[model samples]
Target: MQALRIGTWNLASGRDGSGRSADAATLRAAVAGVDVDVLAVQEVDVGQPRSHGADQPAEVAAGLGARDWRFAAAVAGTPDPFRSWTPIEPPVLRGPDQAPSGPHYGIALLSRLPVRRWSVLPLGAGRAKLPLQAPDPRTGRNRWWWFPDEPRLAIAAELGHCTVVATHLSFAPHTALRQLVRLRRWCARLPGPVVLAGDLNLVGPVPARVFGAARLVSAPSYPATAPRVQLDHVLGPAGLDPQRPGAHRLALGDHRLVTVTVHPR
Candidate 1:
């Protein structure tokens, strides 16, 4: 089979710090520049007031002319709908298939390649009060906000040649690791080589160690303007050949778009 370009990005509600949403034209241009075959996106808002109720998955697929896409909600309601929040949901383990119905915060996948089937898994429902830092809208003060619930999810799609899993783990290092362990076990059940992509939350050698896969791409992706740490990644099962220097960073959204090419067996 031919090689394919796959990418992962956390679109901050399809906007920048200026609180302006990019027009469809600009979004299309950005995706065109990346030239990816499959794209995994996180922090997508569905029917939320912030994103103008944009169906982010469908919008991006239309922009890229992708053949298929899927979206799964992690949280139901946005605490601060008008304002942006990092680690949007509270750190709680909700049912994998149970996201509060209606408008919510979530993740999605877009694939230009043909997808045979797909599935979703909700991991790490354990609740913890995490110290979330965000600017207060009224006071404009950067303060520590303790959020009570946070949830993580993993979505997998089986394309003709490979199975790609998209997920966003918790910001807490230990929690993220625990979810990764569950994800690994889940991926093992699928056929063919599995391509894992998304924001792992925990950076450095920890992801590589826990996943037991080759890190195909490694670059600063978070805080796009002045990225210092690598938070996004494209990982694949052992023996799958990843092209060196094929990984690239695209300037789009708050998190830089990271992509990699793998020769399909």
Candidate 2:
């Protein structure tokens, strides 16, 4: 049996918690700090101008020595302020070898361990516009805006020992709960010892109740600099042991990287 250190982070597209662009080295170190063998990153950029048109996943993957990784694009364009962005009709899934064209935004799975297969689940975008507390691009200060929901999706990688799933759920009132139900159905059909990790956007004790599993890893991850809520997570089977890093060494983004070690079947 193989044990793995798994981690999840909503990177906010390579931007630091202070809203500063992280250089390649800083980006690499941020991921490395978590010290995870397999990582699931959400809100990542692919060929986006804001992130300097860089493939954020590939950059950090190379830095972390992750030989295998996949970026699942949920939308075709950036969800910029005052600009409208639409979901990718079919969505785009890109591997390391593929040169992903156009600016796309989504979640990604990167692993040092080899994966036997890859799959995706579509958690459609919410219709309601919601108010969000975000940073001002010009001033790097917190601001509120009625942001429209973007497309949501999940990616799962089947390793020899276990299948790992990653995603970022919509924050709309009851939409996230509905999405979790669908995701639970999908996980039930997969192989045994399936591990789920990502930002569900559901806080308090809701995830454990909705996901139908004990939270594998836990911490206040949101608002990275001074987190007060646990929006990110890692969930696994009953017998598995969960662990967390002592603390985040860097402000990777608005959410801190949550990690745990697990024995795979």
Candidate 3:
């Protein structure tokens, strides 16, 4: 391939900036606007009534024209204000006959390019629910809570020459650091240079160091209305062609989208 385009976004389960529900059309359009070959998405809803029972991963993949994609359910139930999520024993089913069908919520990775193979790495849920800084609906004011240290996972799509990994780490600082460390070690066993895309929950420098990557995309994606921190990232290995990053605010969601393109090694 001459160039590789990658992106990452947290869909906020199809919620608009004001925390209003976004229809499937809005969700698809927001993702399509990025125009990336590979995308890693977080806060996805599958077979959930809150998202109008739509499969978020499938919708975005269709919008992006991605031929290969997978959604790993970190939690297998409707986790809402009235309830909490429980972790799946093994997010990836053991065999072809047993894929997860839900009322579940988790992360997803989609690719327009042909994938040689796909894999998932589970990052277990953090033990405690911690205070997090985020947006307050359309007001864009800072809110310090309303989040859980949810179960996490990394999904990789090997596109022959390079592998693109998608993940959302825990909000707890130490747990997120440990998860990033594990993910970096896991990538070491993959075939070639790897590009990781996701909302790592850690600030820029920490994830870069842990993943052994050069932070290419530097968009401050949190609090999409007026972002102050770059929680979303696109990190690539050495020998990558240099280029500026792209950040886009979507129709809805608490975070912005981050994209970057690089010449193939």
Candidate 4:
């Protein structure tokens, strides 16, 4: 059986100096550090003002020696408020305003394999009504909320005999559930084996149910530092078995890189 290796990470590239623009050395290390046939990335900035209008997806892809790269701009373009920190609501939340041309902060899939087919699945309509709160490590203030306008998206690509879907879901449980429903429907329509990976933003039985019945493998992936929630995941059809399952911690983003190897059953 042919083995397929995949890796995913939510590289938080934005206006904030959160190590979004990974240096060449860091990118090289990240690529060499993980073992995967393809890499799926979230929060990649494209022509974002904060990123100095750099094409981060292309930059990282080139750094990893991956010439074939696919990208979907969840947020096309918007107004930049010069200096503003207020978190806007979804749909209107205005993703990384800096990036007004393409996905304010979109997802990207980079691979050395030839892409046979591709499509994007928008997660929610208008703006997702989800809430996320994180304690400011620097300020000790809790209840910080930021809603991303670009609804989570699923990008599916056909690689030889397998199909790969990469997405980043909402933190809201209901929104995630709705996204999964759409995901399952899409997966059912694809030909050949299918594999899905992303930051689902939920934990426990919910995820298990969505991908579990589909016979996709599930492994904990989240909080790159010290994972308390299994927000990230990798799932494949029942016919495939996980050869190895694990995640990598990096200082560049809040999420870790989940890598998995699968063998046909």
Candidate 5:
């Protein structure tokens, strides 16, 4: 049986601690350390000013020694006016600094094998409004919060004999459910043997049912310090089993890299 090893990680702006930025060496080391055939990365800042206006996907792909790579920008064009965040310091680079432009953050897929086709699916028309849920520290009561706008996206690619889809869902349950419904419809049109992976932003049976995916027998992949939920996942067709499902302990980002080796029908 042939198996495909998949990995996903949120690079956290490709930055390390001490306010220093992640370089080619650092990115290369991270990917090399992971044992996966394909990688789905989120929160990747491409052509951002703080990242030295570097194309992060290209840089990481080069570092990983991957010949083919594709990126889908969530925020295409200028930065969202509502988001007023700025770079605290400039990044270290071999060349002169360039102004940041285009998508502020987006998703990317890097593969050692050739990708026959790829497409980016918008999660929703615009930012979705969702009820907030936060645990109170003192009162020990759950509080409600509302996020005005959130970016959501999914990318689908056709591999040799299967289709691979990656997405990052919203924190709100309603929003996630809606996105999941759309994802299911999209997956239905794909060929047999489909794999969906990413941060669903929700826990429990909702995700499993909406996507019609079988959860991997793996540990959780959120809050790397001490994971409490399985926010990151890789689901495959029925009867398909993940050879070895597990999570990484590295502090690469808030979310740990969830990987699975699966044998498709």
Candidate 6:
């Protein structure tokens, strides 16, 4: 059995807790310094103003000196200032140094191991209400609120040793449950030993039951200031002993990177 370190995080387009935008160097360090063999990233940007219109996934791969990476765009424009929109297309790998043709938002996976095949499966296309704590338009007071939902996606890459899947499920509770069911079925068809990682936007226990996979990490990963829930995760097929599963706190986003060490089945 070969051991591997897998990690997941919602990058929030590389914005730190203070709302400071990350540059190429900062982004690079975020990936390289994390010390994980494979990483699943969510809420990434491509040619979007919030993220300085950068091709984030590609940059991250370059930062890690990785040749294998895949990105799936779930929407066409930035979601900041939340408004309804549609995804331009499914996520695809950007060629080295290739510029984004338009602003896009999505999820990605970066790996030091070479990927043998790739596929992307999109979930619900309809809008769903997502609760948030934001400034109310009328009084500018910070309050609990709701916003237009974004498309969800699952991108999978078959590596030489294992297949890895990454995704960001819906924030809405009911919607998230449905997505989990779909995710389980989708993963079932992929080659094993499979590792699924990402900002699931749900509690740790929920997915564990559905996937029949061991939940390797359980630390709070969201609201970086005082995280109370484990929104990020790294899961492996059942009966696999995952060692040293934990979360790595960073000043880069509203999430603590979730990680685990597992031997491919």
Candidate closest to the true structure, highest TM-score = 2
User: Each prediction's TM-score against the native?
Assistant: 0.83, 0.91, 0.89, 0.77, 0.79, 0.90
- What does candidate 5's lDDT look like per residue over 140-234, in tens digits? 46677553445677887788878888887776778888888998898888876878888887775558877888886458777777788877878
Candidate topping lDDT:
2
- Indicate the TM-score of model 2: 0.91
Pairs that clash in candidate 3: none
Candidate 1's error at 256, in angstroms?
A: 1.2
**Candidate 1 or 2, higher lDDT?**
2
Query: How well is each residue in 4-32 modelled by candidate 3, as lDDT tens digits?
Result: 88889899888986677677787788767
Off by over 4 Å in 3: 81-84, 93-100, 131-147
lDDT of 2 by residue, 55-168 (tens): 888987987889899999877776655644576767667999998788888899999989999988888988878787776777977889778888899899988888999999
lDDT of 1 by residue, 27-89 (tens): 566667567899889887767765676666667777888887888777667655243334433
- Worst-scoring 10-residue span by lDDT in model 1: 88-97
Candidate 1 residue pairs in backbone clash: 90-149, 90-150, 91-149, 91-150, 92-150, 93-125
**Which ten contiguous residues of candidate 2 have the minimum total lDDT?**
242-251
Instruction: For model 5, give the 10-residue run with minimal summed lDDT.
Output: 87-96
Q: Which stretches of candidate 1 lie over 4 Å from their true place?
A: 17-19, 23-26, 81-101, 130-144, 244-252
> How accurate locally is residue 127 in candidate 5, as Cα lDDT from 0 to 100?
55
Q: Is candidate 4 or candidate 6 better by TM-score?
A: 6
TM-score of 6: 0.90
Model 3 has an lDDT value of 0.81
Q: Relative to the unseen true structure, what is the C-alpha lDDT of residue 100 in candidate 4, on a scale of 0 to 100? A: 38
